[model samples]
Target: MTQITFKQGWRQLISGLADLRLAIILLLSIALFSISGTIIEQGQSVSFYQNNYPEDPAILGFLSWKVILTLGLDHVYTTWWFVTLLVVFGSSLTACSFTRQLPTLKSARRWQYYKRPSQFEKLALSTELSYLTLDQLIPELKQHRYKIFQEGNQLYARKGIMGRIGPIVVHISMLIILVGAIWGAFTGFMAQEMVATGETFQVKNIFEAGKLSKAQIPQDWQVRVNDFWIDYTQEGEIDQFYSDLSVVDLKGNELKQETIHVNQPLRYDGVTFYQTDWGIAAVTVQINNSPIFRLPMAKLNQEGEGNLWGTWVPIKPDLSQGVSLLTRDLKGTLLVYDTAGKLTGVVRPGMGIEVEGITLKVQKLIGSTGLQIKADPGIPIVYTGFGLLMVGVVMSYVSHSQIWALKVDNSLYLGGKTNRAQVGFEQEFLAILTALEKQQPQLVTSSSEKG
Candidate 1:
């Protein structure tokens, strides 16, 4: 009795999980949470959230930085709650497939011959014809491409069985997609890097990483920025930027080289680097017969104007007197400023300007490339699942129709039904009945001689 009760409980659980309404609700909930993830920027520092979502004037009157952090909104995709939702939803799909879709498909494949004339009356379309033979009906069903089965006097035919299998395929595809999403959430990582020209660096500055993402981070190789440059339009506007990058091994051997721009990226060892941004790194200058020096440039916030980079150069050995140099582009134009913040002179590359009894010659401006790198191993599985999903959707559109014919005492009882496309199925059934009617005279003469 205990074993029977346990089995009943298990069956009830499966049946509840297969409910269509429950599946729809879970699907909508997942979509709502995913939208929240997009709205709340994922993978940001605590200071960023504190400044953006202050407690005094919380967004939506309730969402503050404290609330965001407490709920793990900074990295919503890998959150425990989000992962749990995925697992539960996947279980629902699995139960529905086994308890509903699979059983329906199995029932459709099995032969179901109508042995009594009363069964014909229960169908959507049924008819009676005198002196009709199974041999005559077999030819008509074959012409319609229907698979036939006969037992003594009862006959059954069916077509478009793929329509029954389509739902199962769709369920399998959903399960595959869910598995891919969960796997990626636990194994992928994202990082950003700002590399200057002629500089080699390894992957660091990771802002987001899954629990199992350590192995995904590149530790065997490094990347070098060979050069960085930008193209300007005739109107002095920025057109595009390019970065020539090389993949190198530990011993500094070049493994690959490519020029990447906005949409193009470099892929190596399961990690992908995308060109996202650019900036001025530093400027090289010569202090009148002295050794060349590379001074780091910093971006200045100027209202109304675009990006501007500035740096200070000391003309005196004691560093008591200096000049502020600023530029808006890599075209070698430099705006010089005196110690009192007055405009002193405008200098270009290889040109010298006198300041504080010393000459400073402007050299070339160095540029840096901003790259967003990511590693995702589940992308292929997700793509394949989507492909199978499309095939399943197309197959589900075909109608699964079945026909039954029972010859009883010189009269033919015929009936047919379809899972979908009722109007089309009815028309086809009528056409077969008309064909049989046309052969009624020949059938009558043969029946009379046999009697």
Candidate 2:
């Protein structure tokens, strides 16, 4: 009695896990938390959340920066609970596929030869033809592309078996997607770099990185920005831009090179570099009586004009009086300011402006390119899952169909069934019956051929 009880309990547990309801609930839970991860920015600095989702103004009055930190909301995808959900979902798919889909497919494949003509009444469509034999009926069923199985005076046939396998394929593809997402969550990293032209830099400044993704990070190779330039329309608005980039080995050998722009990116090994933003890093100018000097420019935030850089050039030895050189863009005007905070003059590139009784020439501006880089190991698997999903969806539409025929005494019994597209299947089944009806004339056939 105890052994039977344990067996029944175990079967009940398996049934519960394999239930469609359980799978739906788990899927909904995963989607809800995934949405939360998107709404609350992930991998932001502590100070960032502290400002936006502060303790007092706490977003939604309950979710503060502290709560995000404590609950690991910043890295929801890689968190234990999230991964656990993925694992459980995958397991549910496996269990459901094994317990339900596979068995359903197996049942579809295994044919049952109708031992009695009365079985035809159990089908959705059945009838008795007055004058039909095995030879006349076989040809009509053959035209319909059904595989035939026969015993003496009995017939079974089926087609569109893909409809049975389609569900299994869909379940397997879903499992593949879940595994890919979990893999990416544990092994992907995102980093941002602001590099000046002609400068080489290694991958660092990781804004978001997986816990075990150190190996996937670019460590051996470096990136060099050969040149950076922008294209502008007649209205002086940016039309597009380009960044000439190269992947370099540690020993100074070139690996891959390309001219990347917006919507275009450079890929090396497993990492991808995207041109995301741009900035001005420094300016070159000629101070009075000083060799053409290059001074680092500090970017400023101004009203109505966004991209602006400024630098103070000392015209006096005491460094007391200097001109504030403010620039609008790399190729635009430079505003000169006196020590009294008055805009003295406007100077274009290669032009001179009088400041503190001396001519200060604006020479050129150097530009910096901002690049965002990322590497995800599971992208291929994810794409493969997507392909499988499309194939499975198409296969699902084929319509699993079945038919049965039995000969009792001098009459041929015919019936049909389908798992989907029943109206279409019915039309085809009726057409086959009509064809058989035309050939219903009696014919002689050997009973030994029934095998």
Candidate 3:
């Protein structure tokens, strides 16, 4: 007996670990972590932490490598503690269902009638009418579309007992989703890159920085950016942004092309790409002389540089000196130099400064375009979980009921019960009993005969 007690205790402990309470607690914890991730800007640079929390001792202390390593907060969801919590919750649910729920379901499936007077007295809806016998009750319940069952001197009636499994099914679906999420987090990869319009590069890393260990790009996919465009409102607010993207197969042939926008993402080979952002970038500069085409010279340079200078010597014998030029702030300064490279006067854009012999003018400023690239592999699992969760919720809210009847000594007894959605079930039960009274010829006759 002691051994049996010990075993039972151990089983209960295991079952409790897998209970819905544990799953709820774990889910709440995950929610907290998600909230924390949102509130704390992720993927920020080290300098961002320095700038944002400079004097905050706690933040500064948490930013240290030791604390990050110990807490695994850098990659919260993937951390051992978080994963352990998920595993424990999942195990608890499975254990609870296996040890407790399965047996309960089995017993519910077995035929057992409610006959105890004390039980009947305890019920919220109980009626004792002399006219109703077990036989009449059974047929009436059958007419009402309830599954009927009988035991000696007792009647077990049920309808929609299948609804009892709704919570379990929902829980199982959640477990599947959790498993998928964990699998993706461990094996899946995500990475982002910024490309100028018409520029492309292979994704070489999985994470923004050191948040998670880097993962390799999958072998079958090669992504390229064909074009990026941003449409803006008349008031200068951004209206929409999109990227034209192409995917190449392993053989270097284009497999697919798609236009992806902010919310609408491009999916290929189990991966999805989203257009996250766009920026101005990679500008080049050019210099051309104005008014006369004598010395046409063009120079290319990166934007935002401090200085630009160029010189042009005339080919004509009559023109002995060359023009010296400098450009700043979209303006040009021109100076003339003697054949010997001597001191010259300055000139600005559209204005000629007398130098060794000529005048110069500024021509153009060009701009480059930039686009943001991103890919996530966990989306499919997340979406599948969402779909199943909705289904489970709907099933749980719809109750299943059954009614049974038995005849003994020319008297009828009726029994009925539902798995869930009790209020609606009760209302339906009442409606069915009322219909039986009005429709059944023998039902009223039996009641009067008994009276």
Candidate 4:
């Protein structure tokens, strides 16, 4: 009795999980949360949320930094409730496949020949015909790609068995997709790096990462920015920026090298580096035959013009006086300013300007490349799942048709049915009957000749 009760409970659990309405509700809830994730900006800092979703004018009346952090809306895909939804949806698919699709496939695979003429009358399409035998009907069914089975005077045939397997494949594909999503959520990481020209560094500034993403981060490799440059259009506007990158090992041995631009990325060892931004890093300058010094440039945020970088160069050895040097592009031009915020002069690379009775020479401008790096281990699985899903959808459209026949006292009882495309299947059934009808006189004549 205990065993029976356990079995009943298990069966009921499976049945409840296999409910179509429940699956739809879970799917919709997942979509809703995903939309919220998109709208609320994932993986942003607390200060960013504090500024964007302030309490005084909370977005949607109740959305604020506190609410967002409490609900894990800052990273919805990795949230506990979101992941639970995915797991439950996957369980529902598995239960539906085992409890419904597999059983349906099993039933479709089991074919039987009807021994009684009365069996034909129970079909959706049934008719009584004269001058028909298994020998004449066999070729017609075979031409239509039916798999035939026989038992003395009764015959059975079926076609499109893939239609029965389609639902099962679809369920399996959906489960695979869910697994890929969960795996990516737990194993993938994203990071941004801004390296100056001729700089080599390891990935350390991780902005967003999963709990299990430590393995995905490169620990034994380093990336080198060999060079960074930009192309300008004829109108002096920026066109595109390029980064010459090299992948190296801990011993400084080069593993791979590539030149990447916007929409083109360098990929090595499962990690991809995408060129996303560019900036003026520094400028080289000399004062009155002094040794050349590299000055780091700082970016200034302006309202409407464009990007600008500036640096202050001290002229006096006492560190009491300095001149501000600013540039808007990497075209080697520098704008000099005095301590009183007055523009002194404009100079270019290899050109000189006298500042406080000393000649200041402007040299080359150094550029930096901003790269976004990511590693996703589940992409291949997701792609393969989608491929199987397409195949399953096409297979599901094919109608599974079955036909039965019994020879009884000089008359043939014929009937058939299909799971889909009812009108088309009826026409096909009539066409087969018409083809058998056309051969009747010829069969009789052949019989007479045989006699």
Candidate 5:
């Protein structure tokens, strides 16, 4: 009695797991959580959500900063609930593929040769040749490349088994993609650096990292910005910029080098370095008859603002009178303003202009490059899953067709069915029937000879 109850409960569990409706619900739930992951910025500081989603006027009328933090909206992909959702969805796909798709594929491959005339009559495309035998139909079906099975006078022909395997492949591919996403969530890191020209640095400024991301992060290598420069248009407008970068080992031996630009990145050992933004690092100026002095330029605007660097150049030993020099970029244009709030002159690098009767020479401008680097171990696996998905979709287009033949008494019955493309399959079955009818006498003579 206990064993019977256990069997009943196990069957119920499998039934629930293999339900189409349940699988669809799980898929939709996964998509909904994925959308939330996209909508809520992931891997952000507590202050970020606090500043954006305030308490008085919330983001969506009820979503406060505290709510976002408690719900793990700042890092949705790595959250326990989100990972559980993915694992559950993957389990549903696996269960459905095993209990549903695999059995259907096995049923399609099984050769169920028709024995009675009524069996053929039940098919969508069924007919009988009054004077035909199974021998005639076998050759024509074989010519059509249909896989045939025979037992005495009965025969079965089938083709396009790929249709049976397609859904299974698609389900497995989605599972693989889910695994890849979960793997990457626990083994990827993103970092950013604003290195000046000719500066070598290690990966230190990490904005985002996964739990097991140490293996993905670079520790034994360092990167150097050999040079950073911008390409300017003829109208002095900014064009694309580039950074000459080099990767070195722990002992400072160069291993690889590349010149990266906007939309182009350097990749080495699974780590990618993208040239994102640029700024002016420093300015060299010669005032009056004095020697050249290099001064650091500070960005006047915050993040996302236009690049504008400025510094003050003192003209006297007492530092009482000085000119404020402002430049947009490393294009060598500097605006000189007097201490009395008067526009003085526009000077370029290597050119000296009289500012309050004192010669102010702009010497050289140094450029800095902002690079965003990232490493994800599961990216290759994700790409492989996508490739398998495409192949599976193509396979799904093939129709799973089955043909049964039986020679009963004086009549030979032929009928076939397909899981998809029914109209086209009907036309093909009719052609096969017509061929059998036209060669009825020859088919009977051949069958008699074989028997």
Candidate 6:
């Protein structure tokens, strides 16, 4: 007996470990850690921490290279502790659903037609009305949207009973989502590539900084950005930004073409790619020079000057001094100076300038373009989980109300109960009883009538 008791206690302990409350606490802890990871920028450079937090000892200590490496905070989501928390939470939810939810649902579905009026009287929200006959009360109960359960002198009626399953469904959905997320994190790879306009490049790795190795693209798949555009509001706020992309195979066969924007991504081959950002890049300009004409221009913009078109031209014959030519909105103007600290003339792009017997021309401009890339394999599962979660939440919150009616000799009794959403269920119950009394006046005794 003692051995059996020990075994039972152990089983109970194991069962308690898998409870819904434990799952909630585990989920909350994981959420807190995830929030912290986001707030503290994971996988950042050591210098970045040094610059951002020069004096804060806590940040300096925790964000050190050794600490990041030791604690796995550099990649918190994929870390062992984070994954363990998720797995534990998922197991708890699943256990709760199977162990607690199923039995509850079964009990809710069971027919309770033998409950006595004394049992109904014990309920907090029960209603007792003396009526003339069962015939009148039955119709009245049905009018209140209650399904009837009748046995002998007792009748049971229920409405919205399915609502009892909501919380269970919600828990199941959460489990599915967590499972999907875990599946994605372990099995999926993310890759990013920045391509300049009219240029194509293959993505080799995802930027995980120091933690994750570079990602690899499939040999059969290729991605190209056909174009990218950004529209800004009059107030300089971005209104819309999107990228036109084409997917192709190694044989150069086009597989698909799609436009992707923020919040709207493209999916193909079980992979989803998001359009995150775009930036300016690769600027170039051409200049023309001849023997009779000369132009000079700096590659970058001058100090304290806006990006204006300009060229430098040396004065004819002497050639020691030069004139600066400037253009605004295609209109040309000139400023003159010499090499000796004197003011130099501004010049427009494409204009020729002469200095020291040589002619110079403004040739070209160049700059960088930026692009943001992300690929997640688990989005489908996540979305499925979200759908399930919504359904479960709705089911859980809505009440399944049941009313019981019984008749013994000349007396009639009615009682109702709801699993949840009790306030609404009570209102419904009152309305049904009122309708029953109206239709069958004899069943509702004068003493039971409200003032």
What does the lDDT come to for candidate 6?
0.63
lDDT of 1: 0.89
Clashing pairs in 4: none
Superposed on all Cα atoms, the candidates' RMSDs to the truth, in angstroms, are 3.9, 4.1, 8.4, 4.2, 4.0, 6.4
Q: At residue 244, what lDDT does model 1 achieve? A: 97
Compute the lDDT of residue 419 as modeled in candidate 5: 92
Report the C-alpha lDDT of model 1 over 1-451, residue by residue, as the tens digit. Answer: 9999999999998888888888898899889889988999889999999999999999999999999999998999899999888888888999999888888988998877898887777788888878879999999999999999999999999999999989888988988898888888889989999998999999999998889999999888999999999999999887988999999999999999999998899999889999999989999998889999999999899886888999999878899888899999887799989888898899998899987667889888999999999998878788888989999999999999999999999898888889999989988988888788788756542111000
lDDT measured at residue 132 in model 2 versus the true structure, 0 to 100 = 76
* Candidate 3 C-alpha lDDT tens digits along 222-276: 7767777667689856688777888886566888989888888887655667677
All models: lDDT? 0.89, 0.85, 0.58, 0.90, 0.85, 0.63
- lDDT tens readout by residue for model 6, 237-300: 6687777888888776779988888888877776667776554333222223434332333334
Tell me how far the alpha carbon of residue 434 in candidate 4 is from the true structure, in angstroms, after superposition: 2.1
Better of 4 and 5 by TM-score: 4
| Clashes (N, CA, C under 3 Å) per candidate | 0, 0, 26, 0, 0, 37
Residue 364 displacement (Å), model 3? 8.9
Candidate 2 regions with alpha-carbon error over 4 angstroms:
1-9, 302-305, 440-451
lDDT of 6 at 179: 78
List runs of model 1 lying over 4 Å from the truth: 303-305, 354-357, 438-451
Model 4: CA > 4 A from native: 303-305, 441-451
* CA error at residue 281 for candidate 5, angstroms: 1.8
**Local error of candidate 4 at residue 153 (angstroms):** 1.3
